[model samples]
Target chain A: MKDHAGARLIKDMIFKCAVCLFAFISLLPLYLILYYITKNGIMVINWDFLFSLPRPIGESGGGVFNAIIGTVMLIILSCIMSIPCGIAAGIYLSENKKGKLSNTIRLCVIVLQGTPSIVIGIIAYLWVVAPLKTFSALSGGIALSIMMLPVIIKTTEETLKLIPYHLKEASLALGVPYHRTILKVILPSGISGILTGILLSVARITGETAPLLFTAFGNQFMNMNILKPIDSLPYRIFYYAMSPYPEWHSFAWGASFILVVLTLALNLFARGISVKWKIQF
Target chain B: MTDRTMLKERFVKWVLITFALSSLLFLFLIFVFILAEGLPLFLKVGLKKIIFGFKWAPTKGYFGIFPMIVSSFLVTFGALVIGAPLGLSCAIYLSEYSGKKTKMFLKPALELLAGIPSVVYGFLGVIYIVPLVRNYLGGSGFSLISTSLILGVMILPTIISISFDAITTVPKTYREASAAMGATKWQTIYKVILPSAKSGILASFILGMGRAIGETMAVIMIAGNALKIPTSILDPLRTLTGNIALELAYATGDHRLGLFSTGIVLMVIIMALNYLANFGIKRKPAK
Candidate 1:
């Protein structure tokens, strides 16, 4: 019995050690990525990189002003197309849980969520770019909006579903109109979750390059037109990193650092807001 | 209630319904547009040749995607091999072994990992993993091995988070009973908790595989995008998603159609995997 106990204890110790080792090994990639990006990217992030346009070949001082603006523009454009309808569709899902329409809508969201970003980009290209005869930020926005819709719709539905049914009933009992009750009472109660979803969707798309590869097509000069092709941070990283020039590679690294910072900040902020501001009722 | 209030409520319901219908309309339109663009390829080239043909020289009038199909499966399988063990270990640690502080730290860390963009992961593969593979292991650093490693790391959060939740949900009574029977913690975990949570863990594995199959930019950066079927782990290869992203920029005529057809194939594969995962989820332990 004593020998058996010793063998069992030794086996348990070995298993625990192996699990701990493997668990830390899984985190190795995250550390390597953060270390490499910060090391290579921090040197090039002065004001000029943030505010000025890329320079012509052989000129050493140009910035990625165009890409930064374009990224923000794309985010805004996608949000405009996605948010209101995402909330309404979510409301429909929550209110009509057992209907065939809701089931179909739920299936659509799942399918869309699983669809590859590049696939979405291609369809967006065929739909908007081919029809318009040009690659444009609008097309990029459309592609991104499609990606955003699933996250927003699911988040909104789950959040609103958790709100006490009595709250909705109480609002109706007080003579609030049906629309007002939904729009004012239930929506407000779930604002933290809704906002967190929107922020997370934004963060997800902010570093997206594949979807924007064809639709945005990318640009070199500073331009604001929705119909024109625009440079985004991810697109710029892809283009520059693929280029042979050492200077271009440095620009890619700097852009990557900014992109990483942008995404991480958005993610952390979304979580913070969701946890801190969620109404307890 | 006033008539105006009643009328306004009805109008608002219509508006919400319209919005809801529009959401479904978007999904419908995506299928329609993809099919409209891609279906002609099959009619023009026949399904067998496009799907089974080994060569994909579009300019020379050939568009076989058999190699890409093979590459997609090979890399995804390799990723699961590398990732699943590490991911499961992490999930076990988080759900069973960790102190409160470690769990808190690790949970947010995984989210940060997921938040890192695919492009950056690709960039990292280019600069970091590729060099290591080339210098130490052999071949051009850009090969099946490098792509699989990058993908393995990329899918860890998905596997860890899902399985962690699954393992955590196993009834506390199961653990107590196993301990009462004189089982060690490891034995109890393997016999009771893991079996109870197997469906969820399987669901996570399936979802991670879906992610690996669909990943494009990272594979493109590391996989060398060769058009041939790789006979070894160090060989470079193209995948369905990579093929579309690589050629769509300049492809026109039948080549463009070919890429769209590739998209259709990709969507079907992903949706099928998702269906499988959902089946697993539906069968999850109620307790």
Candidate 2:
């Protein structure tokens, strides 16, 4: 009996050690990526790097200012396109929980969410870029909005579903119109969740490079025309990192650092909002 | 109800329904566009040749993607080999052994991992993993091993979080019953709880596999984009996604059509994996 107990203790010790080791392994890459990017990227960051535009080839010092502006524009445009549609879809799904239409819509959302970003990029190229006869910020935004749709829809549906059914009954008892109840009560109650979803989707698409590759097509200069080609942070990183110039390599690292910071900030912001707005039942 | 109010309600309902149906319309549009663009290649080159033939030179009209298919599978399987054990173990630790404090810290870290962009991951792979592999394994820095390592890291969040939830959903009574029978904690976990959570765990694994296979930017950055089958872990190879990403910018006409065909192949693979994952999730025991 003592021998069996001793064997069991040893087995428990082994399992515990294995679990701890694997957990460490799981975090190591994340730490290393953050460490390396910060170590290298910090050296290239400066006031000029933030404000200046890309110089011509063979030039030593150029900033990703154009890319930064372009990324912001794309995010704004995408949010404008995707958010209302996403919220309404979410509302419909929550309202009609069990039906063929809801099931079909849910399936479509899942499939859309799983579709490869590059494939979406290609489709956007066929749909918008081909029709426009040029790569445009609008096309890029349209592609990203498609990518953002499923997440927003899912989050909104889940959030609205969490509201107690009694709240809707109370509104109806007060003789509120159905449309007014949804617009005034349901939407306001779920606003925090919808906002969180929007922020998260923004974070998700901020670093998207694949869809923009064939849609925005990467401008070299700082131009603000929505109908014209534009540069973005991810596109800059992809283009610069692949180039042979050592100077461009540093630029890529700096852009990467900025991109990571933006994404992390957006994530933390969303988390903060969700925690702060946790409804007490 | 008055006619005015009734009209307003009807208008709002239709508006909401239109918004909802747009997602389905978008999905249909995507399928139609991709198929319309991609199917022409099947007629030009034939399906059997594209699927079974080994060569993939678009310029020479030899667009067989067997090599890319092998590469994508090898890389994804390699990532699974490295990621699955670590992810499952971590999930087990979180669900079965870790304190609340540890869970608080680890859960957020996992979220941050998922939030980090694929391009940032690709950059890191280029800067670190590529060099380490080239130094030790003796090939161009970009190789199957490097790509797999990066993807393994990328998929960890998906696997760990989902499996953690799965393990947590197992009834406490099962563990109590096992303990009452004089089984050790490890024995209870191994013999009882794990079996109950198997479907959920499998679902996470399948989803992670899909993510790893569909990954493009990172794979393109570190996989050398070579058009041949890798002979070893140290050898460089390209995937279907990588092939399209690398050449699509300059491709025109049939070449463009061929990339869409590659997209179709990838789409079919991902959709099948997704269906399998959903099935697994559906099969999980209700709480």
Candidate 3:
């Protein structure tokens, strides 16, 4: 009995060690990526790299200002297009949960979420630009909005659903109408979750390269027209990295580093906010 | 006197319903657009030629997708093989061995992994992993194996988090019952905890598969972009996503249509996998 008990204890120890080892192994690649990106990519960061316009071949000094501006512009435009639609749709779905219309909407949302970003780009190309005969930031922004909608709708609907039905009932019993109750009471309660969804959509759009390739294309010089071609950070990174110029490659690294920082900050911030809301499981 | 208010409320509901229906319309339009653009390409270029032909020189009219399909499968499988086991073991460990303090630290770290962009992973794989593989393996300098390894690492967090949640949800009573039987700890975990957690493990595995299959930038960066059937892990290969990314810029006419068809094929494969997974989960929700 003593020998059998000792064998059992030894086996338990081995199992625990194996588990720890697996956790460490899972983390190894992320560490390597972070370590290399900081080391190789940090050297190229400076004011000129951040502030000047992209340059042509053989020119040494240029910044990715155009790309940065375009990315922000596209993101803002996408928000304008998607936020109202996504939120309203989400609210309708939650309010009318059992209806056939809501069921159809729910299925659509799931399929959209799974559709690849590249395919979205292609569809945008066919519908938005094929008629207009011009590729513009507006087209790119619309494609991104479609991509962002499903994420926002899914999260916001779930969050709104979490607001106790009693709150709605109480407001209604006090002579408030359903729409007013939703607008004033439930939405406020669910705002944090809504913001989390928005932040997640923003993070998702920040890295997207495929959709913009055919829609927004890329511009080397800074331009502000929504109806015209615009440079974005992802396109700039793709172009500069693939170019033959060393300076272009360096600029790409700097842009990538910036992109990484922005995504990381937003992601971490969203996580922190969700925790602060202190929602119960 | 209250007629105006009733009218306004009715208007608001109508507006809401219109917006909701439009969201569904969005999905319809996009899928319709894909089928419209892609179906013509299949008719023009026989399915057999597109599927079986080896050469993909579109300019020369030798377009084939077998190499890309093979590469995608191989890379996805490689990632699964490397990532799934580690993730499952970590899930097992988290559920069976770790203290609360350890789990609190570990879960967030895992989440952080999910947040990192594929672009950064691509840059990392290119700079660090490709060279390591090249130096160690001593064949084609950049190869499918390195890309697969990077994908494996990138997806580990997804597998671990989902499976961990699944395993932890297995009732403690199950573990206690096994322990009370005087079974060894390893034996209890293997026989009792894992079996009970099978559905969660299966779900996580499917999610991981979805991620691996759809991944673009990281695999493109390290897969060497060679269009060939790789006989060895050290050979270069191209995947469907990478091929689209590379060719979408200059492609025109039927070439453009062919690319969309490739996208359709990818979507079909992904949907099939998702269907299979959802079916499995529905059949055995208890797991």
Candidate 4:
């Protein structure tokens, strides 16, 4: 061990450098992805492209107002359907931690969470589109809400679990009703964490193209009706990027840029809230 | 007021329980409805043929999906080959070599990489990876190798962050003991730290495999989506997920059922992967 000390030291140094070198190389994709998206998409974005409706294939110069509205509506609708149920479900799991029922529910959530997005799209089509006889925003919202449930439920449950039992016990001792204590006291304390989870889940679905492909279908013009088919950033990107026309390809690039921005902002915003607004308790 | 409180508590508890149970319901419904829609194809074509049949032509009444099955698992294996080592090296770099400031900067940079939508990765693959592979390697840009390379990048964040978590859990005393025994730092890491964190790292790779298999739009674009089974990494091929997404829009009759069956197979494989990962994570290193 002592005779070849210098050689051993040199070998370690070389190995360390190799590790660092390869690690740095692994991150090149992130830089390449961000730079390429910006390079290809930046020139395509302008007020006209952002605000106005897209022109038909032959005509030039339009916007993705429909996709923006569609993305917003899908987010809102999914949030409405998922947040309350997910939080409530989360509360149930945390509150009833030891039971066959809770155990089974947790397993199912894991399975659902792991299920592929394309498979979820098929389920949405069969459950909502097939039965309703049309592709609409309602089905898309349902699909996204299904995707959101496991995330929200797991995050909320984990967050709630970390709260000291004394807090709940103190509320019960004060003669506060169980429902009131949970709804008002326990939930408020974990609000930031729950909100963070919600934001991250929204960000996850924002770029989802498969589920909405058959569920929301796509629309060319502005739409607000929840029952009607709608457009979203990802769907728009897919439609235009696949088109043979160069102009449409540019639209796809612009939409891709918009999507990357939206998801990245949401993720950073979630991280910020979790870091800055977390309750010390 | 006391009676009303009791009633309200009971009501709320029941409501929450119902919501909690809904996840199971969703899973059950997906399985049942998908099976219901898909069983017809199996019955019409026979289970053996549906699963093992080589041909996937629909208009001619053939519904074999053997090729897609190979492509799905093969692509995931290829991604694992590309991603697992790179991700592990990066995880070791961040966890062991870097200081707190570097860790803080690099960790979330990885998360941001994960947060980028899959389709954007597909777009990147189509424009960037495809051309490079075509120009350099002498095949169509859209090939199994290109898909694997891009999917490898997509799965990197998953593998790296989880493996980082795993590596950090190795006891500090183990490293100290190794160093005291005249071991080099590299020797200590390879001999002690990695062996201890094996389960966790294995779990991370399993989850990464699931993500790679489940990916659709990204695979659809850069995979070339050919129906044939790939003879080499340079050949274009379609995954099971790709097949469903590509044909479901216009498929009717037994064709639609076959697509649903394809979904069923995809879900089952993913579930099996999740099951293995769950076991891997749950069995922690002995204290």
Candidate 5:
């Protein structure tokens, strides 16, 4: 009996140690990335780095002001294209849970979520960039909005689904029109979740480089026109990092730091909002 | 008056339905466009040659993608080897052993890890992983080993979180019954809990494999984009996605079509995997 008990205790200890070791290993890369980016990236940041346009390849000291502006513009454009469509689609899914059309739509959204972002970029290039006869911010926006669609739709559907059926029933009983009830009561109640989804989708797309590779095609200078090629932070980082110049390498690190910070902040903010406004059934 | 309101409501419902159905329309268009662009390559090169051909030099008219197909599988398999055990153990720990406080802290950290962009991961691979591998292992730092290491980390969140949920959902009564039988904690976990949660665990692994296989940017940055099949984990090799991204910018004519064909191949692989995952999910409740 003593021998069996001792063996069991030893086994338990071994299992515990193994679990702890794996858990620590899982988190190590994230910490290492944060450490490396901050240590290298902080050295390159200055007022000039934030506000100045990128200098020519051989030049040493320029910033990514245009890329920053371009990224924000692309994201805003993508949101404008995606959010209404996504929310409406989500509303349809939540309202009609059991129908042939709803099932097909849900399946499509799931498949889209699983589709590779690069593939979507290629399709977007064919649809938007090829037709436009040039790489444009609009093409990039269209590509990103496609990527954003599935995420937003899924989140909106899940959030709306969680609302008690009785809420809608009550409004209908009080003689409220169906459309008005959904627009005023159901939508307001689910607004926080819908907002959280939008923010998270934005965060997801903000660092996307693959979709924009052929669509936006990276401009060297500041350009505000949506129809024109534009530089984005991710594109800039990819270009600079791949370049042989030491100056460009530093620039890449700085852009990476900024991009990482923005993405992380948006994600956390989304989480914070969701938690704060979690509605009880 | 009521009829007027009814008409307005009907219009709103139709608008929402149209918005909802548009995604399906988009999916159909994507498939049509990809196939329309990609099928020409099969007509020109022949499907068997494209699938079975080992050489992938687009300039030389050798578009055999066997090497790339092999490389993608090897890298994904390597990542699974490294990631699955670690993830499964962590899932077990979180679900079976950790306190609520530990869960609270660790869960958010994992979510943050998931939220971090693939490009950032690629940058980290280029700056840190590549150099480390080059110095210590003695090859181009951008090798299969480095990619596998990064992807192993990348897939951890998917595996751990999903498997954690799976293990948690296994009934408490099973654990108690095992304990009642005088089974030790380790025995209960290995013999009872794992078996019960096998379907969910399997689903997580399938999903992880899908993520690793579809990963493009990070793999391109670290995998050296070599055209040959890797002989070992340390060897450098390119994947289908990497091939597309690397060449698509400069490619035109048949070369462009070839890249789209590669997309068709990747899409089919992902769809098949997803179907398998769905099967696993569907099977779990039945068990």
Candidate 6:
């Protein structure tokens, strides 16, 4: 009995140690990648790097200004396109409670969410670029809007559902119309959550390259035309990192750092809003 | 009741309903487009050739997906082997052992893991993991093993959070009863608590499998983009996502359609696993 108990204790100790070791190993890559990007990648991140446009192969003077501009454009366009549609869909799903139509819509959202971004890129290519005979910000924005839609809708629906039913009931008991109750009470309550979803979508769409690859068809310089080819941070990072030019490789790392920071900032901001909003409640 | 108020309420409901219908319609259009574009390739080439053909050269008019499919499965399996246990254990530790402070810190940290972009993970795989694998495992530059390790880490957050929710849901009454019967703490956990959470854990595993199978960017960056079936852990292999990402840019006609078919295959696998999770949820024993 002593022997068996001793063996079991040893086995338990071994298992705990193994788990700890595995957790450390899992974290190693994120550490290494972040370290490299900050170490070598930070050197190139200067005012010039941020302000100037991307130069041709082997040129070291220019920056990722065009890509940054283009990313903002894409995010704005995507948000504008997705917000109302996503919020309304989310509201409908949450309020309907249960039905065949609602279940089908829910499943459709899930399936759309599961579809790969690359496939979305391809279809967007066929839909927008092929017919228009141009690769543009509008195309990239629409592709990203599709990607953003399910995320926002799912999050918004969840947030609205989280709002207590009693609140809506109270407003209705006050003789308020349903629309006034929703607009004045429910939507105000859910605004932070809706914003959280939109911020996440913006952050996600900013870093995406595959969808933009087929839609934006990456350019080197800034162009304001929504109908013209545009540069984005992810595409620039992809193009520069793989190119034979040494200077371009450095630029790729810098672009990556900027992109990461932008995403992290958006994420942190959304988290802060959610936390503050929760505390208020 | 006021007529204007009734009209406004009806308008709001109708507008919301229309929005929902439009979203559903748009999703249906995507499916239709995928089927319209992808189904024809299978018809033209026959399912056998695409499924069984060994070669994947588009220029040569040959489009075999066997190797890519096999590699995707292998990587996902390897990742599960590495990730699932650690994740489950982490969940167990968090739920059963940790104090409030630790739980508070760890929960958010775990969630942050899932929020990190796939591209960043891919970058890590290339610069850090690939080299580490090359050094320890003696690979050329990159390998299936490296990709699996990175993906395993990436999926850890999903598994841990879900499993944690599951394990936490196991009632205190069971634990109290087992303790009253003179069962050791460890015994109660292993024999009673875990068994009760079996369905939830299984569902978590299925979700992890879905994430692993659908993953693209990280695997593409480290999987070496080779088409051959790997004989060893260190052997380079290419996945369906890797193939599409690398070659989709220049592909035309039949080749492009082949890529879409690969997407279909990926979706089918994921949907099947999702269904498995749904089944597990439905099969859970009533309290």
**Candidate with better TM-score, 2 vs 6:** 2
Interface RMSD of 6: 2.4
- Between candidates 5 and 6, which one is better according to DockQ? 5
Q: Residue by residue across B1-287, what tens digits does model 4's lDDT show? A: 57887788889889988999888999899899999998887888898997898999877878888899999988999999999988999999998899999989999999999999988888878777898999999789789999999889899999998889899999899889999999999888888999999999999999999999999989998999998899998999999999988888778777888889888888889899989988988888767
Candidate 3 lDDT by residue in tens digits, B19-122: 88878989888778888888877787888888777888877777788888888889989999999988888777777777899888877777767777776677
lDDT of 2 by residue, A1-281 (tens): 99999999799789788888998889887788788888989999999999999999977787999999999999999999999999999999999999999999999999999988888888888888888789899899999999999999999999999999999999989988899999988988998899999999999999998878888889989989999999999999998888878899899999999999999899999999999998545
- Model 3 spans with C-alpha error above 4 angstroms: A1-6, A243-247, A279-281, B283-287
Q: Which number leads on lDDT? A: 1
DockQ-wise, the better of 3 and 5 is: 5
Compose the digit string of candidate 6's lDDT tens values, residues B134-217: 887797757878877888887888888877888888889899999898665677778998899999888888888888888777
**lDDT by residue for model 5 over B170-258, one digit each (tens)?**
88888898999988888999999998888889999999999999998888888998889898777899998898888877787788888
Categorize the docking of model 2.
medium
The better-scoring model by lDDT among 2 and 4 is 2
Q: In order, what fnat does every candidate score? A: 0.76, 0.72, 0.49, 0.80, 0.65, 0.33
lDDT of 4: 0.90
Cα lDDT tens digits, model 1, A146-262, are 999999999999998999999999999998999899989999999999999999999999998988988999999998999999999999998888777889889989999999999
Q: Please give the range of 10 consecutive residues that has the lowest summed lDDT in model 4 chain A.
A: A1-10
What candidate 6 gets wrong by more than 4 Å, as runs, is A1-6, A27-33, A244-246, A279-281, B1-7, B282-286
Collision pairs in model 5: none
Candidate 4, residues A129-241, lDDT tens digits: the string is 88888889999999999999899999999989988899999999998889989987899988988998899999999998878878898899899998889999898888887
Number of the candidate with higher lDDT, 2 or 3: 2
TM-score per candidate, chains pooled: 0.98, 0.98, 0.94, 0.98, 0.98, 0.93
Query: What C-alpha lDDT, on a 0 to 100 scale, does residue B268 get in candidate 4?
Result: 84
How far in Å is the alpha carbon of B243 misplaced in model 3?
1.6
Instruction: Give the 10-residue window scoring lowest on summed lDDT in candidate 5 chain B.
Output: B278-287
Q: Please estimate how well model 5 matches the true structure, expressed as its whole-model Cα lDDT.
A: 0.90
